[model samples]
Target: MQLERGVRTVKLKDLPEPKPRPSTEGMTRITGRGTSMLQSKPLINIVNVVASATIDQRLDLKDVQKKFPELEWNPDLFPGAVFRLKSPKTATLLFSTGKMVCTGAKSEKMARNAVKTVVQKLRKGK
Candidate 1:
């Protein structure tokens, strides 16, 4: 027996209409244990680290890799990007996720200040 090898045909009229999605205004109830409480206010958390300098221009994958040899700087995997700067006493790691962890910083204030500066710069750029 010989099998046919050709393009198949279908009529558009035979197709069914696509289902409509729920409206945005509708209330979405949560049933999970962790999120039992209703979130009346906005949930605020850090998610981006703003650098003082223009990050896209000043920082790159190679720069981060060179400064922090410990971290594997894969731009593709970490799409947000990372910035590393080092002084005589301190080394700072700023992630796209609004969190900066500093090592060898002179003081806690210095580390906090650095993160604040970066956050300001990022916001200004945006």
Candidate 2:
């Protein structure tokens, strides 16, 4: 009898380390929709997920910008902006609304955690 075998390959790239943004708790508010009394808060919009691994990996802003030119890839403003996660195997998405959608997360907890982290950062203005 004969047996079949399969092989997988992995590649390494020089990606940038995750850079956490500053806290945004006391940051000034940015004008948004609604009446003047209703001010809008600042937030991060993470998008795309090219690849990820068990261990945390770095993300290439330039590459991501090249891919999604529409998005405003501002490292200074929203650093630590990652679309993919290692353990959860998930990707984040942003929309015009003040909400984010996390896709591909292994479990609900991962998705919630991702959103919570982002929200906390936004609240902190980081």
TM-score per candidate, chains pooled: 0.30, 0.31
lDDT tens string, model 1, 31-81? 686465343454565434332322343444364456446554566766534
Per-residue alpha-carbon lDDT of model 2 for 5-42, expressed as tens digits?
34633333333545535663344545557433324355
Candidate lDDT values, in order: 0.48, 0.48
Name the Cα RMSD for model 1. Answer: 14.5
Off by over 4 Å in 1: 1-73, 76-80, 84-91
Candidate 2: Cα lDDT at 20: 36
TM-score of 2: 0.31
Which predicted model would earn the best TM-score?
2
